[model samples]
Target: MIRGEAYVPEEANDVWLSVIGKSLAYLCLKQAEQADPDRMSGVLAKVKFLMGLGLSQDDAAAAAGSTAQSVRVMKIRKRSSSGKKKKKRRTS
Candidate 1:
């Protein structure tokens, strides 16, 4: 069970929603200001795009933090799920 903030879609024409999203993005930017302020603008842009895409909360958060695991990571566990230990297959 993953836990994080919730993403709620606002009306397409909701002025306040747009404002608030932008505001929150701005706050995130400010929090990360020392790292690279210019990049914050890009973050803001991506956030807007994700919101437009209707991504779920977890997806958006991962995108925002750049913490989304790569496809390889997601599939790695499956590769080892066969349960045949490599050492057992080797004979001296």
Candidate 2:
């Protein structure tokens, strides 16, 4: 049963209707995002929230419409401050 009061027809009682007959869920989600100026698909919010809660960059990126590899590289770049450390020479 669709318990939520929101008009998320994707949760309809009939499976086939929701999957194909009634409406596409992606389009509905996009419409909802378009209606709100503050939300960019509302995905970034969730992604950031997840990351804040200890989720890895790869997982967070997937939810944020970003690639895992890209997130990894971004994290590396963000954390990197200086160039490679210099090695000390030992005196004999």
Candidate 3:
């Protein structure tokens, strides 16, 4: 059901196709950050969305024409930047 480097299966529906198509198109755009291969925030969001839909990190990255490492880095950066601290519990 999923597509990968060696596997190219047909999309099950138009919705999935549309989202993936848009993601790929965004990734291929020519931007000022030509030296950086990854498409950055918008593409990262798409990759995350795809991952939420059951695609593996590598597969989502490949679908967005990005590397899994970059996706992981983006996720880590996002998490760190969120500034959420764990609450301390009081011992009785």
Superposition error at 36 for model 3 (Å): 24
lDDT of 2 by residue, 31-89 (tens): 65577647644554545554664555565566467887776666566556456555789
lDDT, model 3, position 16: 78
lDDT for predicted candidate 3 compared with the true structure: 0.66
- The top-ranked prediction according to lDDT is 3
Q: Judged by lDDT against the true structure, how good is candidate 1?
A: 0.54
Predictions in order: lDDT: 0.54, 0.56, 0.66
Per-residue CA lDDT of model 1 for 1-92, tens digit only, reads 25886655566548777566656654554566656666545543445445555654445545566533542343355457867555556678
Cα RMSD (Å) per model?
13.9, 10.9, 9.7
Number of colliding residue pairs in model 1: 0
Which pairs of residues have clashing backbones in candidate 1? none
lDDT of 2 at 35: 78
What are the TM-scores, per candidate, against the unseen true structure? 0.26, 0.34, 0.46
After superposition, candidate 3 runs with Cα above 4 Å error? 1-41, 86-92
